[model samples]
Target chain A: MQETIEKVTKVVKKKRAKFPESYIHDIARAAERHDLDDDELDELVRRVKRAYERAKVEKGEAVGTVAAQSVGEPGTQMTMRTFHYAGVAELNVTLGLPRLIEIVDARKKISTPTMAIYFEDEFKNDEEFVRTIANKIGKSNVNDILQDFHVNFAEMNVVAELDETKIKDKRLDFTDIINRVEKAFKKAQIDNNILSFVPSKSNIRELRLLADKVRDLQISGVKNIGKVVIRKEEDEWVIHTEGSNLGAVLKMEGVDKVRTTTNDIHEVEKVLGIEAARNAIIHEAQRTMDEQGLTVDVRHIMLVADMMTADGSVKSIGRHGISGEKASVLARASFEETGKHLLRASIRGEIDHLTGIIENIIIGQPIPLGTGSVGVVMKHK
Target chain B: MKHEMVPDHAVLSKSESNKVLKKMDIHLEQLPKIKSDDPVAKSIGAKEGDILEITRKSSTAGKFITYRLVKD
Candidate 1:
């Protein structure tokens, strides 16, 4: 079977000069399932060539308008609430329309920031290693590792009883916890595994307040990583985090830095640069549309992503971003705050060049797109 | 630098850049801009004002080609 497939693939490659590489590859793969002779293979290639030609866009096609309609039509049908991310009830993420809006708006701070952390090749399938990394990444407060906090009004101090089992389970050092507590509270005293701190006022209220602070103090793990869920995705163990800290997560050992991604667009930009941010926008918008069972083409999302990141930094789709930054005064005025834009343009003596689509449409001229984009040239002999 | 999200970027030499600009019938300022400090630009040692040919894999077009001028 393998030999036959290879022979068929070779034959397809020989005739792939006219067709696209992807088209040829697809045809070859499809040919593998069927047992076809030379005649049938040649016929299949001929039909694919015709179909490929028909599928291409014409020179004067209005692709931008089509892309806009393709994305916007399905966007109206999306749901509008936070939902559990990928069946992980512990991690709630904003999905559907809200998520799509968040992606296109290029919001700096997302409502539910999450990271999908993959591991290095050796540890990808190792469940034990994944759990350890999750523990190291997930934020843990002092309350999580302590059995109970005893507020002693008589002694004018709060004593925290450490849970040794939990500490060891989290792979945290006892001394590290004590040091953090001492640094936070100048009067903190550490004895063996016990941490006690006396409030300066030395009253019942002060003791209770100090105990509360001690309980809530962060003991270990990376900050902003609220919860970590380890689930096996296909052959490997994948870690899904509630809160994202991409910078810190990428720096950790045994992490596959290339594959690990966060839903936070701005954070991705800050960490990986604009191109990664553009890809993030595409992936996120596509995922959002897919999650809602909407079938908007990827090209539309790609176009939107390209526009947002065209200026080296990610910008929002609406006002204060791409729409507001248009070169034409009439175009900007037409998008939003017509009065403000026109007033500002007039004050600055901005010229309306009528170079773009909206400006041309506003002035009763044919929009400079599709068939209307080109002008006739006359020659006098 | 080897990230899957980032497309393949190659710096165009002075002559090649001039030819590309002439072929496209556009000025250097008309092309999309990439910051000099952009991760991929920095990794590929692209200096300011250099034209980069970016090749991206597209679901629709199979392969899409674009250009960016590195800017400080």
Candidate 2:
């Protein structure tokens, strides 16, 4: 089968000359799947060549506006509210229109940040290991495992009664919690399963406050990760987190670094790179569209992603980003903050060369698009 | 970390870059940019002003090739 695939790829490369590697690979895989004979394979390559040629965009096409319209038209039909994420009632993920807007805007602090965490090959099938990881990832404070925090005025300390059932359920170590408490407070001591801590001020109010503080102390898991849902996706148990901490999650052992991803675009850029961030933008936007049952072409989303990441860093689509950075002063002034942009441009002696479509349209000149983009020079001697 | 989404990025040498610039008819500044501090750029040891060839799997084109100039 491998030999046949290689033979077919070689034939396609020679027959439909200069076909891209991806196209050749696709053709070869299709031939293998269909168990196509030589004649059928030849016809497939020919059709692919014709299709490829037809798919090419003409030079000087106004792709940006077309992409904007394509993506924007379907966006109007999306739901405006958040929804429980895929039967995980605990997680309320922003979807549809709001999510699509969030992605394009490239907001640094995205609402409902989440992560889909995969495990390493060795730990993927291990349910016990996955459950432990989920426990480790979901933030659990002292209050979660403690039955109650009592202020002991007579003893000049606060007593925190531990819930054995909760401890066992969470797979928390009794000694580990004690040690954490000891480290967090100066005079914390443990007896049986109860932890007692002396307040610094040594008063009733101080004791009450200390008990509150102790209850809020994080006993386990990575910070900012709220709730974790361990689900069976296809063959393996995957962890879905309500909050995201990509940098910390990637550092842990048995976590699949490559496959584990966060919905936070800026975080992805900070941890991975601009390229990864661009891919994230495309993935996120496409997902939002798919969830809404909208069918905007992926190329339109890809174009928007490329525009957002064209610079070294990710920028938003609106005034503070790509639109604001346009070479033409008139274009920037035309977008938003008209007075401020025009004033800044005038003070800086910025010139609007009337090169772009917006500036040309503003001055009632022929916009440099399609037939207008072509230039003709005629001279008679 | 070899993230799947990052695709394949290769640094083009001076001669190869010159060919690309000539073919595209654009200056280095006109190309899309990648920061020198970018994780992929740092991993590949790409210095500022160097050109990177990024090959991504496109939804429409099947294969897409883009160039980025590394900048601080």
- On TM-score, the leading prediction is 2
**lDDT of model 2, residue A123:** 99
TM-score of chain B of each: 0.95, 0.95
For each candidate, how many residue pairs have backbone atoms clashing (under 3 Å)? Answer: 0, 0
Instruction: State which docking tier applies to candidate 1.
Output: medium
> What TM-scores do the predictions have?
0.89, 0.92
What DockQ, between 0 and 1, does each candidate earn? 0.52, 0.70
**Global lDDT scores for all candidate models:** 0.83, 0.88
- Highest DockQ against the true fold, candidate: 2
Please name the candidate that would achieve the greatest lDDT relative to the true structure.
2
The local lDDT score (0 to 100) that residue A58 gets in candidate 2 is 83
Give the TM-score (vs. native) of candidate 1. 0.89
**Model 1: per-residue Cα lDDT over A185-281, one tens digit each:** 8887888878788888867887788788988998777877888888888899999998888888888999998899999998888778777888889
lDDT of candidate 1 at residue B67, scale 0 to 100: 90
